[model samples]
Target: MKTESMSSIPAGNLAERIRRTGASRVVLQIPDGLKREAVPLVLALRAEGIAVAAIAGDPCYGSCDLALDAVALTGADLLVHIGHAPVDERKGVLFEHLPFDFDPAVVAAAVPLLGGPAVGLVTTVQHAHLLDEVAAVLAAHGIVAEVAPGSGRTPFPGQVLGCSYANARALLAPEILYVGTGVFHPIGVQMATGRRVVALDPYTGDAQEVSADRLLRRRFALIERAREAESFGIILSTRSGQARPALAERLAALSEKAVVITMREVTAAEMINFGCGAYVNTACPRLAYDDQVRFPVPLLAPQEFEILCGVRAWEEYEVDEI
Candidate 1:
């Protein structure tokens, strides 16, 4: 029989937190990538004589997708959620945000590509801890980096989530350098600010300038396609953090053809069953931008829907966020 590796370990405070809870039973939840750590963590907890209630098997994207319901069902006193910080604080839940470290020298690859006198710096949560080191790297290159504070859904300084680019927008710089892995965020920054964006992958040491032109073109096509729809569904999430009921109601009133639809998980099948020609996502912004291919119909952002309703112009286009 094959054996699993124990090289990796769970967060340090997990056991102590369970002890502090004074709860005999506990439920653990983690993102898909970190699910492998569940067994070991549960075994360790069981060794402590704490009853392992159950593991939340449903897909968890972020702290927004808590397994509170599962906890309630299992009668677990506490829910230990890992891999993301809380977007909003909830009782009976503990958040364990995992951090990934990388060398600050990786910023050297992005400095030469930066164009203006001052460059706004932004990164994902995993790299947010090293913002100071990254800024130091830029300073060594004689480049001034603006590491602005974030607000709303993003609380970490210089950290930009898929749903929020408040940190980058706060800088208002002509050029921005995003030190992260994916081009999706760089594209979001470009779309949100209409500024030049260069993305650097810390692990690979690769750098490239990101353009919003392609995304804009695709969004334009989606908007045009949505124009032909007779009715639209304004999707509102039931998730603790993703719920945007007020915005959903406002958008629903924009057009007679639009109706508000609340769902925990907005799947292609659900949309097809609802029979809405198009959709307006008020949940996680990534669903509309990243998962458009999986959706059968055009899913419009709040701003895009406003443009379609004639309440806002296409020139005022912006990415949707919670």
Candidate 2:
């Protein structure tokens, strides 16, 4: 519930955008971590004579998890999705970029640990605005930090998402410096680019070199266990942005035992009900890599499934991205 160092959440652009949309009923949806700002956001919107239909209370992981069902239930004309950029140009949904402030000088703490003269810089959306300052800080230490142009799910240069690391892979830098909260992103960057990665927690001032060896070992074990399965449930996301129908179809064709299963939220219970001996997650890449312990069976990434099916070799191991 603590907002930490952030003083006030800005509503300047939000109100104007809402007015432009001419929406009478709006459903405000925000990520779970920023749900605290919903009340103030609703107040500001209502103050402008915009009727708040309802707040999308479901857990929002990213812009991909648009609260369309909630918007429909409330008969909202517009959905104000906060904290992420648009993954898809879905009608009736507006994405508001939420910026968080942090000192760029924190990059200095990570500079000395960077082993390369030139490094790729990547961060989550919250701190992506500070990339210019971060690059300058790295330059002060004679380190060149290259922030590659963002594409796919990430819309800003140097910005990375848990499900997308296109910005990091674009740079092809020998080493990557990720200024973000968790080790998950940095680890994903390493796997996505096959480069050395260092994660710097801007708030805590903690930096560490990341390795995919541990995750690889764990995935290898899962693949081995999954081989024992009689059937595979190919998880296809029903979310507006996370859905990869074509990829799911391709993966399903790989094995006769595989069948496509669609769900809004991929959970252990759903996987259990499907009664598949194993699952291949084609949804958010994190569900397989990060949430494996929470899964009832081996939840493999698409590439991992290919490996299990003998189409791809273990040496060709790659991280799944939208």
TM-scores of all predicted structures: 0.93, 0.93
Best by lDDT: 2
lDDT of 1 at 292: 98
lDDT at position 17, candidate 1: 72
Q: What RMSD value applies to candidate 2?
A: 2.5
**Number of clashes in every candidate structure?**
0, 0
lDDT of 1 by residue, 130-232 (tens): 9999988888888888988857667788888898888888986789999999899989988888888999999999999999888889999999999999999
Tens digits of per-residue lDDT, candidate 2, 213-304, equal: 99999999999999999999999999878899999999999999999999888998998898999999988989999999998899999999
